[model samples]
Target: MGCSACLWLLLSLGCVWGMGRRARETVLGTLGKATMLRIPPELQNLTLHCGEAMWKRDTEDPQRKLVLLKYSGGNYTNFMQGRNRFHKLDFSLEILNTSRQDRQLYEYVVSKASEEEVWQIQLEVYEPVSHPSIQILSRVLANGSCAVTLNCTTERGDNVSYNWASQDLSTSGLCSHNGSLLHLSYSLQDASIACACTASNPISSRVVTFNSSECNYEHGGGAGLRTEQLVLLVVVPIVTVVVIIGVFVVARLAMPRASPEQEHSSLAEDGTLHTIYSQVQRVESPKKDPTTVYAKVMMPMV
Candidate 1:
């Protein structure tokens, strides 16, 4: 009987558990059927770092104050429909509704308010500032002549004005107006010149300076010729020396040394008949025709 009783108790608990789970699912499904209005995605992810509440004095009463609320983050729109008010006396957030949904929304709204009295809070907002960067496209060379173009660009700020000035007194072509760019085709007689650019507006001002070293210029006529001349001076002499050495090596290899026997034979063939005829005339003491003896000896050799 005890075991049967235990079995009945277990069955009853199982049924109760199943019914509770089914009821939970039904409630979730009903809530899911309701349309959910999402706050702006930017607002939902915003974090309010600080806020301020200024009380503007009414013109009629002077004693009654009108609330002027200013906040840093975009999440401030979330509290537009909520019935929450900032208490001046205590500087606290107070909710006017007691419903669960109202309470949840109010809690989220109040969390954005400042805990301190004076709301000088810093917030992460999409407020982009214009930061202008300047680059000098052309630069002065060592020869003291230059033509430069100025580039003015901003990451966020538009409608910028550019004013260019050289710190060197001798340089010319200063710009007086502001625009996206200022091109100055000027010449300077000084070395290491610097040009500054100023971008200004009614709210803020920014200045950037470009040094002569950072700018690049095209090689001009005289400069290009000088470079070529220098290269030739360095390279031509080296090539000429190489050619002379190569010629000397080839001549040494082709030159022939004369043997003593060949030199003697050449001398004999040139002067032997003349010497023999002169000797024969002197020995014979008569200048007879030497052609007879020459022809006899030459015929035997032939």
Candidate 2:
């Protein structure tokens, strides 16, 4: 029922102010989804012929009040064109493609005859959680146990939650969820034990695991990578090795082939060497037949 003061509607606060709040309801929506904010189900069926209806969004900043409509003749601003599609007469406000900016309080006031009713809606728009990444923040060895701390993070998530669980089934660690980050620390005496970090939101969840012994998990490195990334890392080296082997084989095959005649010649020259002796005589004057004679000898291959 709407508040009624008729002529005193402006002079008195009762007419402007809603008689009472039906319920403070929270509307949760995912980003880019459409959600409707309507009057309480109890008041939805009320067929109130309102003379004046005013809707104002409660805002903290000193900007234009997100006033959807404010007039006795049912007038709204051009601020809401395609976004707000529902009229308050039907007691429903439809918002499309809700975004982070759309998350706020919306107020609706409708007066029937002389009475006015108010509805306040709190909207929360969240994004689906993407894959979580876990990396070692710090590690210290104390006594026989190694104290390991890990950080988990994700993108496009709201009210994100994180849990650290161990494969040993005996080791449990405490974690804190601050915004989209999860911090966990564990004391492990055995390096063989493994731990997994799970990031979850109201919409989705993802898990990443790492060995407790080797907590050097980096953002995109280490065993914390997504399956495709790990696959690519493994395949790149194998492909490189294969390509090198292929190139070697191709080069060996492309080399010029030795002919049979060339092979025979190579074999014949492999161990054979020719040797010869030469004698020379030289005369300075025509009278002497020979002034000197020199002989040179060379050894042949055995």
Candidate 3:
């Protein structure tokens, strides 16, 4: 039968059996964790006196029963699947290694002396949230104001919602949008702000913090530079100057040099010089044209 028809039938049975009370509850369970569905204190006595207690799942197959407990003549009997994973203690149910498939609507039925009591519970199972991480999407500096965009995400989480908050709650400059995507704009003169991103589900939560000053550096536009970049800027030019000076000194030392006296002595010993009165006579060349004349040279005393 359909779920609605099954619910109608259950309601009809409760009415005909003179149901005493009905209670509704919601329980949250984390994946792979144990959770307890407890019977209210006021209903514990009624459950103990009940002749039959059943835990049924509300689904297309309304006859699907998860657990059944019967008490007769001071003896108790129970039926369920996965005996190792589920336990009943004083009418309370404990589930271990919960999974997403365990999320469902369940009904606890108790019958005693021709009266019935029902507790309808809705189970919501969620994966525990992992540590959230922040990614800087973009950063801009315009007119002394810095605008940064960030995205908050988790590696593993189910049914998680994101919330952003500032470490300093009194700060008026903090702003965020789009839940997981945060956009913040602040003046450079403002104090550095720390932002926290929380990823939470019904069962678990995780938070991550980021400093706005991390994105304050602008590579081409802003005047601010990271510490390492500033160190490079200062140390690189000094290193270049030292290298240039060393190279100039090495080049100067590699060249050959001579003293003034040594230069003069070398020129004299080569004998490539003559005095003005060294040539005394000129003779005509007989083997050549008569007009051609040659001079007879003589070396002057040094």
Best by lDDT: 3
Which lDDT tens digits does candidate 2 get at residues 1-302?
34554534443454345455545778887888887887754344332433465556766786757676554554544357688776655657778778888888887776665565677788888887888776555556565555555667776588888876655545554332343333444444444555567888766688876654433334433344455576788988899999999999999999999999999877756644433444445545566565444444343543
Against the true structure, what is every candidate's RMSD? 23.3, 8.7, 12.7
Q: Lowest summed-lDDT stretch of 10 residues in model 1?
A: 22-31
lDDT of 1 by residue, 21-127 (tens): 21100010011122111222222222222232231112244455333333433322224235445433333333343222321111112122223222221111121
Candidate structures ordered by TM-score, highest first: 3, 2, 1
In candidate 3, how many clashes are counted? Answer: 0
Off by over 4 Å in 1: 1-130, 136-144, 168-175, 213-302
Greater TM-score among 1 and 3 belongs to: 3
Predicted candidate 3 versus true structure: per-residue lDDT over 1-302, tens digit per residue: 99978865655554456466788999988888887776775455455444466666665566766554454434556564452132344666666667777787877777765777888888898888988777766788888888887778888988889988877866633744438888888778877778778899887889887775544543211232344568798988999999999999999999989899989887766664543433223355446544433444455536
- Which candidate, 1 or 2, has the higher lDDT? 2
CA lDDT, every model vs. true structure = 0.43, 0.63, 0.69
Candidate 1 Cα RMSD (Å): 23.3
In terms of TM-score, the best-performing candidate is 3
